[model samples]
Target: MAVSARRGAPLTLEEISSVALRLIDEGGMEGLSMRKLAAELNVNPMSLYHHVASKEALIGLICATAAHHVQLPPDDGSPWQEQLRELALAYYRHVRAHQSLWTYLQNHPEAVADRQMSIWQALYRILRLAGVPESELRRTSDVLHAFVTGFVVAETRGHLPDDPDEISRDFDTAIRLIIHGLAGFSS
Candidate 1:
């Protein structure tokens, strides 16, 4: 973690991602550019290429770094329904906290699949444990993921209740509904 004298320190991948995340937070996905990031880091634009191959790669890195902050609920023999609720709430909080990055990642599902494989796998396992048939697991996962993401997006954007408690209540209601729906399809 030695700081370089140039630009107050040489850029590390972690630093790059941090600055990029900030850029995204402040300016939205369209605002982040290699030149802008390099300027922010006090380095030549080309220097960014040494760390990241392209803007898309940098975005993936930013998303992956953000994903690391999301805490997946542990499988501790809890009821599958409770476990899924925990997972959905955790994911909702994470996306709400990083709305811009999450929104950007939405357009690039392949990148998300590549970088956030662990999170995806965890969600898949939870759905399987809830007795989602093998044939329906993928669809169920997609539906649940979309629902959680869409709910948070709406809440964060003020489309939902302004009160935190109300939002939480609504979120819980939605989760229970989805879980109940899944129960109907479970073998």
Candidate 2:
């Protein structure tokens, strides 16, 4: 069944965010236009503006919301390796699921400071747990984050070839290799 929007009432911020997110999910960031969003919501484009300040702000909110979807596991009982793996897989799935978002996220310089701190912090913790020196933790986290995010961005743009199981398997291999290498460095 299709839903229609009324011209009388404007969409809420959440509603606008949902519609925008859906648009990005369906098409890349370029696919998310105010007119397209309004059409999807079955409302006048002007009404959307009432809720979202502008297209840029709307995109920012969507990025923030997606960033919130990231989950970090408890550190007490779980091994750092397991936690990092889960986080990486979660990040991978998120990127694949919202490939459009990756396009916007990559180009936005403020993205790291603005909405992606949770992801960076988690990776930072994992690197620290690996006994990596504190001086290098931030730098290491940046490198590791870039590695995965770059992979996602390339994949999203179709720059990277698609292989059904390749992402997870290759990531798993890479993480294991890195951890093994870290162990040697520690010892």
Over 16-135, each residue of candidate 2 has an lDDT whose tens digit, in order, gives: 787788888887777889999888878877776666678888877787677777776657757777887888888887877787677667778574365246777777777777778888
Candidate 1, position 110, lDDT? 72
Across residues 1-187, which tens digit of lDDT does each residue of candidate 1 receive? 3343566666788889989998988888887999898888888788788888898888888878877767888879888888888888878887777778878777777767762366777788888887777888678788878887787778778899989899889988999898898787666
In candidate 1, stretches whose alpha carbon ends up further than 4 angstroms from where it belongs are: 1-10, 108-110, 156-158, 185-187
* Model 2, global lDDT: 0.73
Q: Estimate each model's TM-score.
A: 0.85, 0.78
Find the number of clashing residue pairs for candidate 1.
1
Query: Which candidate should be chosen as best, given lDDT against the real structure?
Result: 1
At residue 81, give the lDDT of candidate 1: 85
Any residue pairs clashing in model 2, and if so which?
Answer: none
Best by TM-score: 1
Question: Which consecutive 10 residues in model 2 have the weakest lDDT in total?
Answer: 1-10
